[model samples]
Target: MAVARSRSSAGPVGYAVGDITSLDFPDGHFDGVRCERVLQHVREPDAAIKELIRVTRPRGRVCVIDTDWSSSVANGFDHLDEDIAEFFPEDNDPAAGRAIRSRMVRAGLRHTTALPVALRFTSLTDAGVVVPFFNCGAMQSRVRAELIERFFASVERSVDRGGLLFAFTMWIGLGQVPLGSMPRNVS
Candidate 1:
C-alpha cells in the first residue's frame, strides 16, 4: 500500500489524504473501495457517496459498513444495568448508519444491502472501560440507563450463549460499479 501510494504521489502535494468528496486521484481509479464509518461524519454525505462511486471503476465493488444505534438490541437491559447504561444514551442520533444504505444506491451504485453482524467477547470484566469507549459517556445517569442495561444484557447473553463479553451489531452495505467504466487515475 505504501509503495502504491508513493507512486501515486509524484510531488510534494502528491499524496493527498483529506476530504473524500474531492479525492486526489482522478475518476475511475480504484477497483475496490471501503468506506467504513466515514460517510456519516461528512457534512455532505450524499456528495461523499458520489465521490466514492466516482473514484471506483465501473466494474469494481464498494463495501460500506456502519453501526446502527437505533437498531441496537435490548436483550439485557434492566434497573441493575444502570452502571452500563450511564455511558450510552439513546439521545444522540446515529444518522450515518441510518442514512448510508439509501445514500449508496442514490449515488448511482447498482446494488446495496444491509447485513447486520454482531461480535460478542465475554472475557472483558471492566464494563467501565468498554462502556466509556462504546457508549460515549462518563459516569452514571438516567439518560445512560438504556446503554448500561444493554451492556449488562449483552454480557449476560454472551455468558448464557457462551461467556462474558461485549456484543454490538454492524451494518454492511455493498454496491457494484457499472460495466465498461474502468478507473483512470488510480493504480
Candidate 2:
C-alpha cells in the first residue's frame, strides 16, 4: 500500500497537487501563478501554460523559471561539442527550454525572454551534485566527472583572479494575463 502525502499548510495558497492542463478549478479563479522547473518535464508545456493563463484573473502575474540545458557548457573542455553530443542525445545543445518563451507568446502570453543567472561553485563536490542530473545520464558518468573537473578548475582560476565568482545561467520569464472577460468558447 502507498502512503498518501499530506498537503502542507505552508505551501502556495490554493495550490493543488495535480495536473496543470486539466485543473479542477473554475475559470479565472487565480490571481497569480508561479511555475518553476515545471515546463521542462511537462509533455505539453504549451497547453499547460494556456491553462495557467486561463485560470488566472485579468492583470494577474504569471512568472516562469526554467533552465536551458543547451546553453550550459563544459568549461575548458576542447571537445565540448562531442562531449555534449554524447551527453544529451535527444537535444544536442544547452538551450533546453529556451523555446518555451515563443510557445507561451503564441498562446497569447506576454512574457519576457529567459533570464540568465550564475551559480557559483566552491568545490568539485558541489559540481558533482549538479553535473549528474544536468547531464541526464548514468552510463556517461565518466564524461560528467570530467566535465565537472574542468568546470571546477575554471572556477578556481576565476576565483584566484577575482575571488570566488560563482555564477550559473537560468532564465526567469514573467508575463501577465490581460484583464478581460473569458471567451465564451471553451475548447
Candidate 3:
C-alpha cells in the first residue's frame, strides 16, 4: 500500500503483481526493463531473464542488479561463511550476482556490461540491517539460539579489539536487446 501510494504521488506508472518467468505484458511492450535482487530467489533465473528481454523493445536496455552472497567477507567472524551456507543452502545461488552478465549474454542480449559494487561495514549493527544471519532472532529457528548469541558476542568482542570487518559485493548487469528480434519461449 505504501509503494502504491508513493508511486501514485510520483506520476503515472503501471505496476502489476505477476510472475517473472511468465510476464503478462506483450512482446516489445517496454522500452527498458530493470530487475533487482529478484533472480537469487527464483527457481529458474534464466527464464526470468528471458522474459525481461522479451518484453523490452528492440535495442532496449535490460538492467539487472543482484548480490553475490558468496563474496561476503568478515574478518572477525570465524564461521560466518559456513553459517551462511548452512542457513541458505546450495540450491540458492549465492553467486547469482557474478553470473547475471553471462546469463544475459547467453540470452542473446548485446553489449553486455557488468559492474561490481562493494558494500563495506565496520560494525555488526550496520551489517545486521542487510544480512539476516547477523540478527540472532532470524537464525534462532534454524540454528541454536545460544550459538547465534555466542557468535554475536564474539563479533562484539572482536569489534572492541579492533578486528571488525564485513564486506560483500553486488553486481549490476546491463545489456541491450538485439534489434529486429522477436520474443521466443526460453524453455
- Lowest lDDT sum, 10 consecutive residues, model 1, at 84-93
Clashes of 3: 0
For candidate 2, the TM-score is 0.60
What are the TM-scores, per candidate, against the unseen true structure?
Answer: 0.57, 0.60, 0.84
Rank ordering of all candidates by lDDT, starting from the highest: 3, 1, 2
Predicted structure with the largest TM-score when compared to the true one: 3
Off by over 4 Å in 1: 1-16, 74-95, 121-132, 135-166, 180-187
Q: Which numbered prediction scores highest in lDDT against the true structure?
A: 3
Q: Give me the displacement of residue 94 in model 3, in angstroms.
A: 0.2
Candidate 3 residue lDDT tens string, 90-178: 56676899999999998999999999999998877877777777777677766666667677878888889988888889999999999
Which parts of model 3 have CA positions greater than 4 angstroms off? Answer: 1-9, 135-147
- Candidate 3 — what's its lDDT? 0.85
- Candidate 2: stretches off by over 4 Å: 1-15, 76-96, 111-113, 120-168, 181-187
